[model samples]
Target: MSQTSNSSSRLSALLLAAMACAVSPAVVSAQSADSATAPGLPATPTPNATINLIRLMVERGLLPAADAAKLVEQAETEATQARAAITAAAQPAPVAPPPLEPDTVRVTYIPANVKRQMIEEIRSDVMAEAVAENWAAPRTFPEWVAKYKFFGDVRFRYEGDFYPDGGVPGGTIDFNRINTAAPVDYFSSTSTAQPPSYNADQTRERFRFRARLGSEIDLADNFTSGLRIATGESSSPVSQNQSFGASGGNFSKYALWLDRVFLKYEIQPKAGSSFSAIIGRTENPFFATSMIWSNDLGFDGLVLQGKRKVGENLTPFFTLGALPVFNTSLNFGTDSTASSGGGKAYASQDKWLYAAQTGVIWNINNDLTLKAAIALYEFQNVEGEVSAPIDATTLNTTSGFIGSTDSSRPGFAQKGNTYIALRELTNSTLPGAGNFQYFGLATPFRELAATARLDYNHFEPFQVSLIGEVVTNLAFNSGDIASNGPTQLPGPRNNNSFSGDYEGGNVGWNVNLQVGAVALQKAWDWTAGLGYRYVESDAVVDGFADSDFGGGGTNLQGYTVSGNLALSQNVWMGVRWMSANSIAGDTFKADVLQIDLNAKF
Candidate 1:
């Protein structure tokens, strides 16, 4: 049915071919020749669309102009007959039915091969637009922006502190305050002032909350960066729970602190396991429990970490780090060693902690696994330094006042660690001569620790795990601590001196058994566990240990029981109870209860 066209109609044929080729591959314009398409879309099943389809075949030289014209004519006739058939099927025609529809996709010049190719091209275009305007996680953003991911969590807790009924009220020394702020005057004959007292044997309750927001960005290489901010009542490194409004006013806004900022890089060798390095403040690089490193503590400085896969069921890992504990002040002796212009210069006494750990993960079978590690952490220049004897008669005429090693004093400390005074006053005659003073840790801290965990999943959806860790402070020596200046224990001080007995110990350990759902996910799924702990006076630095057991610190013995229930995805609630008592100091004990609601993204 092809009629050859002469030169007279060749102009028309060329024009039709040009228009058909110029149309977008995805869309036939909504304003096609007769505007034969659905509202707001350029799709298939339209008269002009059919004609364009035939002309495109001619333009691609798949069919001649005459044959394309013949096809178009036949397609129009079929469409007209199809409409008449539809009208007759309905006893009384409503009105002229819409010929073009968003749902109709059939091409009138339908041949099997051509229809398949045309459908593929149009589907490709539709998919591109759908992804760009996707309802969830739109993909139209820049490639670099797509590499970023954000996550965070918020927790609200109600904590109750119950003190023993028979305990006394005010003998505990508030050394933490003295170390960070001012010291009590002890040298003046007329001065009856004493160190600030801690709140011992007091029952209390408070509402606290912890909030954190962070972002992780993946760079082009195998490098990544993380940044986070959190709420904290103070600048303490081990606690991030900000208390609810208890100030003079109600509903006060709180402060946010920089909690984590770090850069990490990793590389997978072509034939071996992966290796990595991290810098700045980030999560602790070593695997440890709260008895060794608190859940909220962040490690700062440089750390190197690696894991080697030995076999299908065995992997060995190691970590090493050097961290700065304290940096010396520039103008440390200004007041005591003052001149007409400014304070005197002092020697630098910075402190550092060097740590290392090696461990392995052993998967014995489908139902059992074991993980174990041994670690060493040594604190350098962390011991207290006593100042030179001061001459009583020359109090006002001294050229230098502060000690050379005063900067070695810990800017922050917790309970259970033995301490000594930094000043060695020679019976000053002046009034209030001991107004400025400081204290330092009596023992250098070098902890050696061994830990292990065994997990069994014999019960289908539940797991049974046995966990244990033992730690000893290798540097803690009662003789060395007592030989220094007057000692300060956790409780009351006796005549500002040591009792001459072995007053402190170096070892601590904890073990726990748990049974519950492997992980929290759906409603009513629950988990419960119980554990016991015993920490000697100097076993581990109390500053970085768990803050919830016995009001936070060491020289404590305790047992903990906890239970959690999942309410929905990314949300859960937990209840915990801890009963703790002092291991061997003045009588002290407490029972703590905490109920928490947590959510994460």
Candidate 2:
């Protein structure tokens, strides 16, 4: 056994010597290549050299294949230790004064192999410490995923409404009455005639919540795509709040709707100047107050915007866009056996909105700035035309009046537009069919608006601003609206005119003053503002106006006060109150209050 052991030891020594000769030149070549490639990169072991050493060992019977692998691993480890030691020693050591005696000399020495072993020991200790501390390599993400960004906000609110005892009044119930004539009562019982009365005094309160999630993806260069999903009823284009008990019955999940999906590309002609074009269902592109368009309204179309810096403080911008409001196709041609044979058939023309705005921003020194803009919004095919009814089947059976059987209209009833039915004297051939009603729009809308804002920023951590806006409908004409309906009233056995008291008004305006932090930041940051507004029924499309004013849109005059306080960097509390009354045709009044807790991430 002793003789065998000695022989094995000799064989191991021979294997080590052979491996050294085979690996030395390859290691030097690797070092040379590494030096040429980059700084601080260690030389890599040559697999061919190591394999040759291992083959020689196995062929000569110096070691088994497995043992040869172990031997090669051990040699590589030693070489790594040697390299590390040499690299460390190459660093310049701290300078020390010469020995006090001029003839005296100092010397320190460390054996090359011993120094290399010490380095290996130190490296082993460092690796063990790292493992004990759970150190790990950083995680890696794919290139596309790295380009994505996410954002969202959550809001919880308490809303209140107050209505006076007088209730809403002034709208005429008699379809055949003109503006100059006395109006009929709308709330009277069928058997008894009573004066028109307002709704009784009432107060309502509810809790509501809104949430939105959005993501932006960097497609390439200056192009980006964005998507946002929000919680709300699909029917409302201006609100995302989900009121408690909105489901009508037991607890139900809130509805999720796509709020924005758009693509944007930015062009830079020079420093500090840019132009962008956006398309799809996107955020509002025009700079205007809620008097003309609600802040939450999204435009489904395309927008072009440009900004140019003139000198150092004067910058001008402009925006242009076109949006499709409604689309429909109908078959209104005559057919004898058709469902509406000689009856009214519904048809609608496509509606579109085109808008253009230009504005300038001026910086007057460091503490003050002024901004102003003018815009024009025009609508095409918004007016409707009613076909003459050939028989009684075309008339509204419930009211014995002409009404639209077509589902498509420029706007919904909840939007506060007055819908009139055009009719002509026609006798019913059928026994029970009443006189035909042909419902259509009696008014057309076109608006020109101007707005101005002044900002003073002298107060640190606080901001002060004043804003004003005015809008007028160029297409409004009382005579035209009054003349659109039937010229003569149908016989109710009494005298009545076909035109109700709908005299179109053309002006709307709002003014506001605000003092607060521009945005909520850390805890205790706050803001407050007050404003007054008067919106004529015809100045703007009530359907797209601010819904919170006058319980939901146009022909409203009011005052609003709002305040907000931040709870944290990304959370805030807000309160708002609005008291409003109708501008015309109605004596409606309302008070709205909202308390909100909001958070963003």
Candidate 3:
């Protein structure tokens, strides 16, 4: 046998002998004798293998140390003798040896400490490779998996909507539907479409749910990509909630819509100074309240934002972005439909929004901080155009007006914006009573807004904050809209002419005060806030404003009281109440109550 092989056999024999001592001597003799020649034997046992049984017996008062030593020596002697005897029996040549007395072999007990030391050396010799190869610890995934993160949130809500008892018959006109949806042929004798309107005096209650799941991946350098999906009905930009028992709901499955997909790259030149660029359908880029942009609103476009630290406790920031509000179809006005106005092709009327904002964060003292910002939002090609005069003598108003400027009508709306007919028809050709026509926004929209917030965090877990904002529609021109005349009204108009009601304003403002935890994160964390808002007609785009205010959209004034309490980590419940009335248009009043349970991970 090789030297290494011989040594291994000896070490294995020692380990096996010690193991068999716990059994009987006869078993020790047979097992230990065969271990030395066994194929595929285990690696050397731990050092304790030599004296573990003996020490265990000693600790348990089952055997004295001296007696254990003697038993070990006796086991080793018998095992060796059996191996020798078996070898001799295998020899072909005749060889006889006098046997020892009655299968007895003399024994010399080796001290337990000495045996342990010897076995420990053998263990180190054989286990060296395993330790070097990291055999004891292993991993489950590639290192790249560490760069990805996942998140999600779910909300369940119960809400009630109440309106005043008194109002003009037929209630308030659902102008949002009138402006957003294609104008129907309400005038035709066989028309199936009716003028849509809201239930002004009715009370409504509903259950709704919202769910979202998202993931983010970190790429090389400072680049990141993210994706998210959410549940909603019709995928409204201002809401992610899907009402229960709607749209053929009989325990029907819900649909998930792509809510966010964005790529971003960022760089930090120094402490508190950084810049970033983001693109795709993403969260809003500007820091603004729901008065200007709803909490659930997402932006589709590109933005570049940066911030620079100027001296201690002061940082200035700026943002620039371009967003496509709506894209005109390639053939919006090429067909001989009512909207096409006698098959004449029209120019592109794609709507877009360009914005620029500057803001600053300043630390007034150890306990107080301030944030302020000013932003200008400009809309391009978003104004309506009165169509060319029609030939009155040979006139025929199609099902709905489809003129060159029809595409300027908003793709979505929430009411309260002034409106004018897109087609110009003379008195002789004007639609008779019961005939219908479509309308577009009366004035263009360009917003200039200023906002400020102050926070006192001296209370640590409890903080106090004041937030305020004021905005003006710089593009509003009442005189020009009036000159167009014959504006759309809320109810039936006996004459096809202006109602002499401009019903428009250019300014809006809001103020809010908050107390308690800045954010709800864990059990016992809570927050309470009270706020008031006034939005004049045409002050802000009704489609993107706070969807829960005055049944949604501008031309409203209201007070909101809300509170949130975290019931557990990553779980919270909230309650809010809003009471509002119209600033113009139809006379209306509403009260909304909402309770929500929210969870995130």
Q: Which is the leading candidate under lDDT?
A: 3
**Alpha-carbon lDDT, every model:** 0.75, 0.68, 0.76
Q: Between which residue pairs do clashes occur in model 2?
A: 166-198, 167-198, 167-199, 176-497, 402-437, 403-437
At residue 357, candidate 2 shows an lDDT of 93
lDDT of 2 by residue, 1-601 (tens): 2443444456557768865555444454444332323322223435445445455545444444555556556555655665676677789999997557877666779899999999999999998886666564344355677789999999999998887655543342222222112222221122145333333256888899999999999999899999999998555788888888886637877789999999999989987689999999998888889988888888998899998999999899999998888775454332222234434445555788999999999998899999999999998766544434444444323232223333223444223444454444244434543443333445677889999999999996788999999999898776666556543332121112234355346789999999989889899999999999988767787668887876776767889999999999999999999998766664567898999999999
Native-to-model Cα distance after best TM-score fit, residue 389 in candidate 2, in Å: 3.0
Per-residue lDDT of candidate 3, residues 5-90 (tens digit): 45445655654565456665554455554443333222343243434444444433434446556655654555566568678868
Write one digit per residue (lDDT tens) for candidate 1, span 547-568: 8888787878989999999999
Q: Which parts of model 1 are misplaced by more than 4 Å?
A: 1-116, 128-140, 186-189, 246-249, 270-272, 338-342, 391-403, 429-436, 486-502
Stretches of candidate 3 off by over 4 Å are 1-140, 169-171, 185-194, 337-344, 390-401, 426-435, 485-499
lDDT of 1: 0.75
The superposed Cα distance between candidate 3 and the true structure at residue 279, in angstroms, equals 1.2
Worst 10 residues of 3 by lDDT: 488-497
